[model samples]
Target: MVVTNIAFIPARGGSKRLPRKNILPFLGKPIIGHTVLAALQTQLFDRVVVSTEDTEIAAVVSQWDVEVDQRSHALAGDSVSVVEVCLDFLDRTYKNRLPDTMVVLYATAPLRRAEDIQSVMNLLDEDCHFAMAVSVCHWPVHQVLKNHGDHVVPVFPELIHSKRSQWDRYYLDNGSTYAVHVDAFQREKTFYGHRLKIHEMPRARSIDIDTVEDFEWARYQAERMLL
Candidate 1:
């Protein structure tokens, strides 16, 4: 059925730090499976599709009741930007008629919850064309160290001794949820288009699994939740 809101998941099969990380098992299921389940549970999407170039990954995602876009090799390389993958799907699936909104969920961040996903989407409005999940910075950088040949100097000496209240607060993309107006996304060829908004997420559920150590840490986090 045609719908105005779609959830697009980009799960490429190659990974240098962790091979097949997109489908790596986590808490008795593929890591991507957790994201798929969360997206479905939110009930915010009219359609949820996983776009991947690997048959193996596609085979695994097929277990769920979601559409799988067999992306081309041109969009699967490590250097290729994720925007290309998303644009390819949008151009092909919707053609000239585009959905009102599209949500991009990464497969690595499995701990993000359905409520958080909804919160991210809820942030989209006329004033904000891009909305995403972010986690408050634990150690917000007040000054940077720049090394000249033999010695290092503070980049921003003025901020070196500033109090926490005086320092600017910082937030980082948690690599979990992102929602954007389809029109703005195509116009800018990126998700970071137009007025951006954020839905703050807890550090506990903001884990983006990229390496073996990250996987282990995420497992510890998820296991603790079950208890």
Candidate 2:
């Protein structure tokens, strides 16, 4: 079998809201472990590399069969972009031999499916600059509030009249995972460029772990699915 040429999991250790969030226990395993296990289960990529600046994260990742690229503090700062970490890792380790494409798997997305990963990989093509897994949602974007100098006001007055939920267009950006060609990513440093594509995932698989409450809910969802 010819495995795809790219794969990477980025887990920085400086989350402020949820300290040590990467290694936090979820579904009887560390949060990062879930992403690692899912990526390994796909068996689609030629290589899987974990990028982190924390030695403890490195130690935990080392237990897996995947390679661990120790990131520097400069690149791992709270202000540094994910693109820098990715580009730095590739530049330092792989040198001129970067992969044809790469998948940026979020460690917080423990509910991500192996099929979701494979689905994005399957959708990759020369025309597509990037493809990311997304779940359609009906967020009340129009009902959102904006603060004026003294008073908060509705962002969209037209939505105040539109009472029906069906009228709203479907929204994206569940923030679970994104797949991009390494070459295109280097050009823009963003996934949603002119030629980006979407690989639709089920809403059940789009649970992103942002807060403690989200973590518990994800665990419950996983347990229910297991049963």
Candidate 3:
């Protein structure tokens, strides 16, 4: 049937805590232009790349005409892992043709929609190979704590002081959507790999913008849920 969805957006630049954060400015677009316009309004991507080593985020994601894989300053570091810039854009643009779905969108999680990435590609059926977009970990994930220099501890140390309403209804990975199955991502290249499925957004669209108070609380929830 020749289906091939490929919306990989990993805008890397020198962001040491939000400098040039994927072309900043949010509510009037620029934050990877609303994640490349929610992967082109989820007309279920045939291709909507953006792997940037930054030529002004590859000229603002080539003005949404998409394709801009110019990465490799040794995969543009800061310990490069958007799964190694998504296997370096599937080993440089689908080498020898391999794309039967691989969406990873995360331009700092711009208020995920476009039916929250087509409902995580409608759970990518056929015994699943991965799909994502979780939320509802509204703090107190089993009293998580760390830093052990005369201070905190319980990072799930037996869920210390456990408030188990079944571990407080947890769910996370709201790193704004993902989907897999490029043959189980070339055999488990990992996005929590095989057989996974989920799609439960709504921590007001799961904000993932790093600091500056999470870009002013995702611009106050994108001005009350992006118009």
Candidate 4:
């Protein structure tokens, strides 16, 4: 049976770290524009929807020729989770016509490619409830440091003596893309479900723009990749 897929992008206006991050210009188009375009280019999703409370963001999404779901004021706060935005979009727009699968694309992930999005969706099987993009940890846990009062402490003090090769490799959520079975997502109300799969992405493509420095790096990387 052919499964229906919908792509949902949540972009709120209130960004404390980087103001107007969703609509911020990355290369030439806004940051969210790249995500919408990538989702559309995959041609795997039946519908591409942008959930935003900001009119400017909605307008930018409209320019991409995709549907926009006006997010509720209650769900527009910084504390509101991405899952909440997606659930709100489903309840408000697709109450009766729910899709078989949902792909949550991050607006700030300008370097996320269409192939990566497709790969994550393809990773989701009948038994799997969630598939997300992940990247190998840049540094071993033992090498990581934390600040505690006036002292600098190792994040994994117990493993400080352990060689990096001694420990199993670790992966971190890239926050670029996520795919979920709609029924499972609705029931669990989260991306993490019983059966989960991960699509490993290269660190270069896994850059999540949350600050001006990150955005600049992404822009430089995107330009280089384009060339």
Compared with the true structure, all predictions reach lDDT values of 0.90, 0.80, 0.81, 0.87
TM-score of every candidate relative to the true structure: 0.94, 0.90, 0.32, 0.91
lDDT tens digits, residue span 61-156, model 2: 787878887888788878887778887776776655567888988888898888889888777798886888888765666677899999998888
Candidate 4 residue runs with Cα over 4 Å from true position:
1-3, 145-157
lDDT of 4 by residue, 179-224 (tens): 9988889899998778888999988889889999998888888788
Q: Which candidate number would show the highest TM-score if scored against the true structure? A: 1
1-227 per-residue lDDT for model 1 (tens digits): 56899999999988889999998878889999999999999988889999998999999989988999989988999899888888888888886578999999999999999999999999998889999999998884876689988999888888898887887779989999999999999899877777889999989889999999989998998888881
Q: Which residues of candidate 3, in runs, are more than 4 Å off?
A: 1-5, 8-22, 25-58, 63-99, 109-126, 133-169, 180-207, 210-212, 216-227
Compute the lDDT of residue 33 as modeled in candidate 4.
Answer: 85
Order by TM-score, highest first: 1, 4, 2, 3
Clashing pairs in 4: none
Which stretches in model 2 have alpha-carbon errors above 4 Å? 1-4, 163-168
**In candidate 3, what are the lDDT values of residues 170-201, reduced to their tens digit?**
78888877898887777788888767888998
| Model 1 TM-score, all chains together | 0.94
Per-structure clash totals for the candidates: 0, 0, 0, 0
